[model samples]
Target: MIAFEPTEDQRLMQDAVAEFAKATLLPRTRELEHARGVSEDIRRTAHEMGLGLVSVPEAAGGQGQGLVTTVLIEEELGAADAAAAFGLAGPGAFGRAVIELGGPERAAELLAGFAEEGGWDRFGAVAWSEPAPCRTHEGFATKAERTDEGYRITGKKAFVGNAALADRFVVFAQVEPERGWGGIGAFVVRRDNAGIRVGERHKTLGLDAASFGEVVLEGAVVRDADRLLGDGGEEGFTRAALRFFVKHALVVAARAVGLSRFAFELAREHCDTRVAFGKPIGHFQAVAFTLADRAMDVETSRWLVWKAAAAWDAGQSERDALLASARAAAHAFEATMRTADDCVQLFGGSGFIRDLVAEKLMRDAKQLMLAAPTAEQLDQLASAIELGQKLDPALVLPTPDTQAIFT
Candidate 1:
């Protein structure tokens, strides 16, 4: 039931995206880096192409094209400019969070606005990470106290993507503090919410085209309807949340695959042209072997990502899907870093210069590794599932209680 070949329809879409990447993103990568965000025209183009809603369910005002297609498109985007993919206007992580945590019914109402007029200017984010762990509780520092009409959320969420741009957020908070990680709850908090405001943006080593900042909720209240109580309580909600993270990581891994591919190609081209001792550098044993290894890295990462994405699409068990995703993502993330590093190494002194893209690739690859759960964390998850151990909420997934990952 596992298929590596994309559908004919998928091939067409891939080609179209590839062309857009080459013509638009690749050329303007430096421009995006300087601008510190995706240009409005490019964001508008991506929106018109339905790039943001590709993986969303049809019932939730999306294409419902499934995860496999999503990874393919993501790879194309990453190959051109991984940073711009994050900067693209759309629900992004917020859409995936709602779909996993709230289901289609709630997502329909919350997500329908993304397709409206001027929707290209809209963005949504998942406020999952925190500035620091809650010292008193075993979960998030952010708390949600029950109120007459709803719950009032209060705390600071850091490393949140599109924080300043997102009008809507799926904010995670400590609901039943006594229950620890099990007490966590998710709420839909709008930017217009009286007590919610964006804080200072972080300047990172890479992915400058995307904004990562803090969301401070000093008693932001959400109505009862805003609660995304998946299947209802602790275990169910935790399971759904874990699934979302793994699937989201898989999507990020596909991008890593593309980054690896681009790096490998860039290195190989340099090796073929650059002469070291009278012949092309690629003819040397060391350089040739490195290129060969990176070639394997690209193909291996792509297949792993495809298999994991296909598992979800094919209705595999949650444990199976999670395990596959963890392995794929872990491998892809490391391979991307290695490939980019080698790409720089092959370029000698020139790679370090800003005039070349090698250094940027290296930095982007490193930053991307943190955009989701780390390879180390993912390996722990894979091992936990393999050993048949009870999946502890804190141990099996990245949480505010443990490592605060960028989402």
Candidate 2:
């Protein structure tokens, strides 16, 4: 049996984050969406409130919390503004990776700057995904060569979060050739480094307020001090130790569930108020049943998130079963997106209009799917676990012989 009861401290943190979201973040989301940028005031507020550095270690410069806490807080922010929600994902992921993978000197240096004295805010972004022949770390083509100074990296990474705004990037590059396992390594590259350029800005569907664009690195020089995980070794051991996939995915799942909850509440409110023919529309079984089903899915997924998060923190060794947890979360998120669309349809023209925020939530849910270790990937992992074999990192699924699995 799995349980998701929050401790007293966690409950307090959740309430505080929810209150802050309602009072400060939610109101400005619309304006920020139109502006496509977060103001310094908002950043400062988040920093002072300890929102920006929540997962970072207290030893260096963070709150020293775990995944469950991070997910809970992100849910409140995500419901208010998806761009802000998306913005935090990178910083949180990168912060953990740095703390776990970076050498002591490098970790200390980066974390201190992240603490942000007074009003100066510093955020970290990871340049992991790339286009063509290389979609993620498994198919990485970027390379870093050992030079007299340190390392010179040259590669193009697309869809790098906060590319335009971040002070430093945890650049992922291939360090070993053809021995075939140095898969990826992270190097801390500063914005002012020579040959490092922020490419075209993209106005994405939902996270338009957050900076989304490409990062081009041409012979970007990195000193030995900047080299984080892998340390010129195969397998990128340091990075793998960080376990970012589960951490980021759980927070993302929480946000999707939160948005769906908001949609459900709005739909219920609308059903009770709007009358069709004689009585309230909610009295109709067809409308009420669909709402009830969606509500159950949201709650179930939310609890599952909490369970997996707890397991991950406790260092539970359920490798074979963990993939299923990720799959369940993905299904829940997908269901929310579908249900939110239905909510829009139920509201008729009013839903389509810019008056209600349901349409935005639907769009936000769609955009969240862009984060990596996609649903298809999760399915592949499940397939591998079922087959009792180590899944090839590069295997694309539906497995060609899809019939074989069923037969």
Estimate the lDDT of model 1. Answer: 0.90
lDDT of each: 0.90, 0.68
Q: Alpha-carbon error at 226 in model 2, in Å? A: 2.8
Global local distance difference test of model 2:
0.68
The count of residue-pair clashes in candidate 1 stands at 0
TM-score per candidate, chains pooled: 0.98, 0.88
Worst 10-residue stretch by lDDT in candidate 1? 396-405
- Give the Cα error of residue 230 in candidate 1, in Å: 1.6
lDDT by residue (tens digit), candidate 2, 182-301: 355678898999869999876677766777778899999999878776333433453243245545666667777777777777788888989998998888999889778878877787
**Which tens-of-lDDT digit does each residue in 1-407 have in candidate 1?**
93369899888888888889889999999999999999999989988888888877777667888888999999999999888889999888999899999988888888888877687899999998898878897888899999997999999999999999999999999999898888889999999999899999988888899999999999998999999988776789988898888988988898888888889999999999998779999999999999999999999999999999999999999889999999999999999999999999999999889999999999999999989999988999999999998788778768765577888
